[model samples]
Target: MNLNLRNAIIDNVSGNSQDQLEDTIVDAIQNGEEKMLPGLGVLFEVIWQHSSEQDKHEMLQLLEGGLKKQ
Candidate 1:
């Protein structure tokens, strides 16, 4: 079967408000379900595509710090 998962996810969440989007993300992360990853990745892709260099740098720094907490 052929399915456009990225577009599907985007379509699903396209009209959400900021608070709804935040709740979606928080719920996905807190649930820790692998099935939710693609949606999260799509969300990140949107964020990355729209972000400035400084914003990307700050996000990378935060990601690096989070990853080092093992």
Candidate 2:
């Protein structure tokens, strides 16, 4: 994803409250389609960029666990 677009999504989520952000994410997931994948990827990228090393490691672990189920 382009850096600007990624920043924009981060800004949007950051501007909203946690509950709202969760709702947005849930909606995206529930509505999952090919089109939604890019958005999710962008969100993951933004989160990865902003997260601490430990947080990133934990996220990677969680993702690995989830992927293993697929």
lDDT of each: 0.98, 0.80
lDDT of 1 at 52: 100
All candidates: TM-score = 0.95, 0.73
Q: Which stretches of candidate 1 lie over 4 Å from their true place?
A: none
lDDT tens readout by residue for model 1, 1-70: 8999999999999999999999999999999999999999999999999999999999999999999996
What does the lDDT come to for candidate 1? 0.98
Clashing pairs in model 1? none
Cα deviation of 69 in candidate 1 (Å)? 1.0
Model 2: residue 41 alpha-carbon error in angstroms: 1.6
Query: 1-70, model 2: which lDDT tens digit per residue?
Result: 3478656666767778878877987888998776767667887777888899999999989989999999
User: For model 1, what is the alpha-carbon lDDT of residue 2?
Assistant: 94
Residue 10 Cα positional deviation in candidate 1, in Å, after optimal superposition: 0.3
